[model samples]
Target: MMIKQVFAILAVFLLFVFPSASLKNLTYQETDKVALNVSASDPDKDAFSIRYGSPLDGNGQWQTAYGDAGVYRLNITVSDGDLSDSEEVRLIINRKEEPPMVTSLKPSTDALSVTEGRMLSFSIAATDLNKDAPRLCLVPGRPERFWGEGFFLRSRLR
Candidate 1:
């Protein structure tokens, strides 16, 4: 009985002295070039295994993409057979800002010539690398004569 009491006290002391596994939350942008490295540590010098949910590669890294902007809950756990620790990591992925590119302008010339009572038409093409819809609009407070025939043009690129 005395030996049992001594072992019990030793176990309690070990619990107070040794620390468990720990992890921290992360936030990243979808356009970030760097990879997200999920790291955890155990101070007991025990062989442990880490378990994290999807979107993480084999090396426990994540390379974000354009459409990956969202909040994720990762249940990360580390276990050393007898003792284990778990953490609910909140990961926030922010959207990347990208501007649209004008691909081409029809009538590809600095000047346009038109005759009286003749109809004139031109077009503009644009694209967005982020897969966002593109919108075309003339600058506000422009001269009404620039838009002859009271026509306004707007186009969306797929």
Candidate 2:
């Protein structure tokens, strides 16, 4: 009967001395640097071994890329030989926005004068570093007669 009581007490003690792990979800933009360190606690001060189930360097650093915009599941485990704890963290990567750049504008000068009932020609070129499509449109409330052929703009003044 005494041995049974001692065993019960030891069970409760072991339960209170177990190790635990904690981690939080993270969010970042593309091309941003990421660094994360696992968090764990052990009452017995035991040495812990950490394992990452995702693509993280030894120092828990990752350099995000342009095409890496999405949600990632990070599985981390902390173990002290006999006991182990694990945590699942979500890492979100967002795409960065960049404005389109005008590469060239025909009739280099900003303004030009054309006689009435005459034809005028111009062109505009632009590029987007993010591989997005570039659009060209006339300003609203402008009194002009023009048609676009790709990036080329041809106009006739009445």
Candidate 3:
């Protein structure tokens, strides 16, 4: 009877000490490489097999794919042979914003000032890594065109 009571108390202690698996929330950018390792615990010191569901592809520590830009609900399941548990992790993948590059601006530094009635020529060379070519417009912020006498000339690269 004493041994049974001791075993019950020990079982309760173990239950309190050893908890189930826990997954930490992850946040990453689309350009960054993502590899999330599962954290788990068991009373018997059992080895856990972890796998990710949804956007994350494949199993293993560094073999997961997280390239898409969105909020992904990653359900990671960990199994310790006999017992299995699942945990949900919110994986946020933010899109990478790359600034457009103005390779060269014509009407170079040498010719900075503009004349009154003379023909003024200006050209801009720009490129964007995300898009095929950088968008150009006459206005600084808005997309408007410059019209002359019977000719439409705007701030764009030809």
lDDT of each: 0.55, 0.58, 0.50
TM-score of each: 0.55, 0.50, 0.45
Q: What is the TM-score of candidate 1?
A: 0.55
User: lDDT per residue, candidate 1, 1-158, as tens digits?
Assistant: 22111110001111111212223446667754323344444454556666556666544456667868887776655666665566666567777867777788887764455788888777888887667889887543335324433444444444
Query: Residue 158 deviation, candidate 2, in Å?
Result: 35
lDDT of 3 by residue, 40-112 (tens): 5665665656667866656322222323567767666767666576667666666665666668777555323
Output the number of the lDDT-best candidate.
2
| Ten contiguous residues with the weakest lDDT in model 1 | 4-13
In the range 6-85, model 2's lDDT, one tens digit per residue, is 11000101111121222345667777776665566656666777776676676566787766788788766777776676
**Candidate 1, which segments miss by more than 4 Å at Cα?**
1-24, 33-46, 80-84, 110-123, 138-158
**Which structure is stronger by lDDT: 2 or 3?**
2
TM match of model 3 to true structure: 0.45
lDDT (Cα, 0-100) at 7 in candidate 2: 10
